[model samples]
Target chain A: MAIIETADLRKVFRSVKRRPGVGGAIAALFSREYEEKAAVDGITMSLEAGELVGYLGPNGAGKSTTIKMLTGILVPTSGSISVADLVPHRQRLENAQNIGVVFGQRSQLYWDLPLRESFALLRSIYDVPRERFRENLDHFIEILDLDEFMDTPVRQLSLGERMRGDFAAAMLHDPKIVYLDEPTIGLDVVAKEAIREFITQLNRERGTTIILTTHDLADIERLARRVILIDDGTIIFDGPISRLREEYGTHRTLVITLADSYEDVQVEGADLESREGNVVRLRFDRRRTSAEALIRRAMERYALSDIAIVEPDIDSIVRRIYREGYTEGAIGSPS
Target chain B: MSVVFSRPRFRLEPYVEFAKVAMAKEATYRFDVFTNIASVLVRVYILRTVWVALYAHNAAPSELPLHAVITYSTIAMLMSLVMDIDQTRILRDSLHDGSIVLDFTKPMRVPLYFIANGTGEVLFHAVLMIPALALALFFVHIDVPSFGTLAVFLVSFLLGYSVGFCINFILNCTAFWTLEITAVQFIVTWITDLVGGELVPLVLFPAALQNVLVVLPFAAMFSTPLLIYVGHIPPAQYAGALGLQAFWLIALGAVSVVMWRLGARRLVSQGG
Candidate 1:
């Protein structure tokens, strides 16, 4: 059975549109307008145990909302969801007992408490036996490099240290599934890498099912095997990471360096996008011709200069979805 | 599920965690344990001066002694360390920053998490009060009467804390429905100080006011219970006052539990 599943799960919000000025504000106190926003419109997806998936989207794309529903933090406006046969937001305490969650933008540790104390508190909160608690603490302390900051209060640790601490805190309960929302939001590159590497290690070593949301493409590339892309509160694409790179319909950029500055260099099979002295930038379609073919054509035409190929990145793929619109990954893969 | 009482330090674990956090949190600020002690002492001294003037013309206090009144406010500062909670911030933060998502996914109930966190804060403040209470010993008048009175005082203080925590929790949990209520808390606290007998002993009030105050949960959470321990009330009356604090604790606790159930179902996980 799938570890997590959602069918047509939807959520909407009504925002008050109060008028401006003192008189309008007073009037709004009596009568105001409300605009409906579908934060998480009808959507469905399922995940198996031990699968590490990246849930991606632009700002306000319902990435958090979807995670909330799965984690039992949200009650959907319509449809149904089951994480381990329990409905989130209904059997909240039961649901909480079965899953673990991590929010990159927030710290779950007690701000006033020492890092070790926070762990000990979690140990009791989850009712972990002392033997098990000691074992888990030892493993977490070793893997996260927490010994240096273990005695420091949560409020005293640096953001990177706190992020590492939070990751360990979430996994303390030994739950079957884990949900992380932007677990690497504000950390430095090295810190982010550390957090990502830890998450990957958890999934591989422990077989813990993981759902992660992040804006950092490197996070998705390194950790998530499957990527779920979303835009405007709807899932635009969901498939293996390799598939996303394969179906990419956008053009690629190629830059060629001439032996010397070439004047009035007009090339065929590839358009000269930019020319600065000896270097010439070109735009071409991969489906239309291979890199070797395009380079050969350029060589015959432009004094046989050196060539460089730059494939489209994730940012442009996301931008294309916004501009041109997507059809297949709107909800998720069928069944 | 109740802790089987076999789990070692299970109950005390959260308190220990809170002490660490409180010290670290306090460390970040311009903190001197003496300054805090001085501030509390200053408040007590001013109140004592006022009471002395009022009693100069009148040699005797009503049923409540002048010494008892001083003792009441002297320990009243302990309430700040125990029950002065700000959990609405947690509820609001979870809703706003989406950390609540992480909490809801945990194996612990949401209200229990906040309660546990509050316990940590209280214990942290309790350690903080050691030196402060010691400093007040020199300038403040606190009569224990007997060692047995000290034990009774501890029991009464705990009951007061339970009621205080449960009441503040219900109010704080309401923020899940409508975001900010700092103003509401302020008004409720001021009323409790004025009429609930935190600032003045219930015995000092007129007969009609005293009756009304005792029947209400506010006094049960603050003054009447504390007075019971100081030998101000007859030992036979301990049962009735203890019953009041327990009843209110259960009542307020039930109300908070119901609100929590509703709030959890109504969870609308916002911004990522």
Candidate 2:
């Protein structure tokens, strides 16, 4: 079942045209010159129940704007959004009851109060049943390892600890869907792993639909099977992670180390990418020449001591796509 | 489902809890509370001295005596402890910082939460007023009105507060159109201090102008309650004064509701 859906969703922000200098600034006050930019332009998509989808994009790619509309914070300039069978903007209060949101850069926790007090206040705000609230709180405390610093003020907590508390707070009411925007923006390896584990558990155990927007590719790689890639306010790609890899991730890197130093080393089918000391990096298309064939050519040409073929990671592929925009063939059309 | 038949169920628990949390947050800064009380006391003493000096020159009229003026000034200062608090300051701050988006995602009414938070802070300052009032009483002699007058004053004061809140809310809503409102806030605060009868009684204005000024909402917020307390407005006119306050409250309340809806739309459209 599709738990969330949007058709041609769009959000346009109209701002006064700001000028360069002090004189221009004064002129703008009287002039009504306006410029409109569509932040989320005609995005159409749907999410199935219990699906963990990575909503990926670069900065100013309308990722946060889309999330805001879905969360009913930013009303769309046009188009329709239905989350849990209700229009999010029109039925915002009802939709809010069914959704949870976490903005990693900003915390919803009270800064002066302990995590416990924040949780207790959320309980009243959501009107969660006393018994159920207790159960959820205990579960989150155990899972997020929040027992040690539950009484510490939010301002005093480390980023990781506060994030854990935030996750718990957003989930206390058992929302049917969760929107996590950069949930792991700034965290150490262990903290990142803990959050990813918690998110996976929430989606799998509770059958909750999750739409995660993150710049961190590792977060997308680990938790989301399906990914939606958007840029310039439109959907460019939408499918499984494997399809993303197959479409844009065709380049392979071959690193060869030579025991004997040669003034010049060259392979016929590969282009030299980079070199450090004795080791040389070569880039080649996987479709044209196999790694085995490339290795055979390098071995015959130079006295190689070690050779390894590196598959293109999602990071490099995404970086390349950003540098050179994707084609319509691999993209899902915006409805 | 008929809309008229189906009354919306208003939840009070969330606002109550929000107010409580706000109170708790306000209590955390104990030193600030003490400093606030100290400043109010200092101002009261200065006002008492200033009024004494002004009366010595017989600049004041016979209808307003020295003791009555002292009571009026002292009560205005005390009333300012709660009334001067901009309940919609949180709204302005949130809009500026863009944290208001999180508030829009909440299940409850955003304005109500701001009100509860403001009420919590006002209640805290209201408690501080007790000590400040006591200290002011020691410095100057203030006339205590009869029990009936005191009862009427309290009712008028509440209406005045509602009117003040609506005005503040309406002003903060301007932030939706203009991202910055600090200059506007300063201008409005200066005007309120001058015309709201906070610094000087409206009765002292020219009798012809006094009638027009009293009908203004600014006077409804400060002058009505203060005048009622000082018996400048007699028993017969209590109903009239309270009724005008009620009128302003409803008028401003309706304006605020309209402004709030329009402002919220602007905020969401601007992607705040």
Provide TM-scores for the models: 0.82, 0.95
Candidate 2 residue B122 Cα shift, in angstroms, is 0.8
lDDT of candidate 1 over B1-272, digit per residue (tens) = 11111122225554454445554555455465456656777877888887777777786676657777777777776555445556334555666555665665555545555665566556656777787677666787676667776777677778877877777877777776776777898998888787777777777788888888887878877786568755777778877878888888888888977877666655543322
Q: Which lDDT values do the candidates have, in the order given?
A: 0.74, 0.87
DockQ of 2: 0.49
Off by over 4 Å in 2: A328-335, B1-8
Runs off by more than 4 Å, candidate 1 = A129-140, A259-265, A328-335, B1-45, B59-98, B120-159, B177-179, B202-214, B226-251, B268-272
Q: Could you give candidate 1's per-residue lDDT for residues A294-316 as a string of tens digits?
A: 88777877674567888877766
Candidate 2 chain A weakest ten by summed lDDT:
A326-335
Candidate 2 per-residue lDDT over residues A166-217, each given as its tens digit: 9999999999999999999899999999999999999999998999998899
Q: After superposition, how far is residue A103 of candidate 2 from its true place, in Å?
A: 0.6
DockQ of each: 0.34, 0.49
Highest-DockQ candidate: 2
- How does candidate 2 fare on TM-score? 0.95
